[model samples]
Target: MNIPSDLKYTKSHEWIRVEGNVGTAGITDFAQQELGDIVFVEAPAQGSAVAAGAPMGSVESVKAVSEINAPASGTVSAVNADLTDHPELLNADPYGKGWILKITFANTGELSGLMDAAAYAAYVAESAH
Candidate 1:
């Protein structure tokens, strides 16, 4: 429900904060709440190519395991290693420390396909009904 205004969102509930040509991405607050308590996470290796809308990682929760899709095409520049030890961080701070990947863009234009905060909030609202 906490959709930050500055970041772009995916229909699948992922969020990306763009800084220059790099983007830091993670599941949205709405996603973590829906997934329940996160128990484990897996991210793409550094330097790996991630195509937009493809699986870039996964999150395991008490309820189920969910594949995390990429919001844009890029090469993964960094992956959060801390997730191996403390997956609960995804539940605790999904937008901050819980970020999964830092990717250097393959095409920044793909960002135009993503939703803004207001649209995502509205999408979540409509999906609930």
Candidate 2:
């Protein structure tokens, strides 16, 4: 529910913090809450080339397993190595220390389809009902 105004969102519940052509991606706080206690994460390899809407990795929670999709087309520039040792970071600090991926731009046009924070909040609210 802590959707920061500066970020954009994907329908799959991932948040993208764009900084020029590079971006930081993470699961939204609302997403982690719904998924429950996270136990493990499958992160993309460093330098992996990923496409928009592709399955970059997956997360395992106490309740179920969920795939984490790319918010936009890009190459995976970095992976948060800490998650392999502490997947609970997704629940504890989803927006900060728990960021899932750092990607370099491949398609700027894909960004037009992403939702702003306000729009995404409304989208989640409607879907929750």
Candidate 3:
């Protein structure tokens, strides 16, 4: 899996790149591989308040529909409108253009609970068995 070392990961397989108090997030490479070809992404509305670990949106793949959970609490500042036209981006470049939403964090302290790239890679390995 392409787990970039700079990002933080959640047990649910989402990854977030934090910049200041804002965070850009998306499903991990491991998640996209498991989901198969992504067909649709239901991103959370802009300006919505989301709590840490809560269901924020859903991604529908050829194989199944999966709920995407928030990695941290914040107000959603933006949603990637491109996904509405090209959900394949999630499978093609999940860590880059496939980002689902950007949030202005409510509490940066919650970041301490997230895993670094190495930890997440190990977690994925453990789960595979």
For candidate 2, write residues 8-126 as lDDT tens digits: 99999999999999999999999999999999999889988888788989999998999999998888888999999999999999999999999999988789899998899999999
Highest-scoring model, TM-score: 3
Give the residue spans of candidate 3 off by over 4 A.
none
- Candidate 1 lDDT over 1-129, as tens digits, reads 688999999999999999989999999999999999999999999999999999988999988999999999999999999999999999999999999989899999989999999999999999989
TM per model? 0.98, 0.97, 0.99
Ten-residue region with minimum lDDT total, candidate 1: 54-63
Q: What lDDT score is found at residue 109 in candidate 1?
A: 90
Off by over 4 Å in 2: none
- What's the lDDT for candidate 2? 0.93
- In Å, residue 82's CA in model 1 sits off its true spot by 0.9
Give residue 63's error in model 3 in angstroms.
2.0
How many residue pairs clash in all the candidates, one count each? Answer: 0, 0, 0
Candidate 3 residue pairs that clash: none
Tell me how candidate 3 scores on lDDT: 0.96
Residue 43 error for model 3, in Å?
Answer: 0.7
Model 3: ten consecutive residues of lowest lDDT: 43-52
Residue-pair clashes, model 3: 0
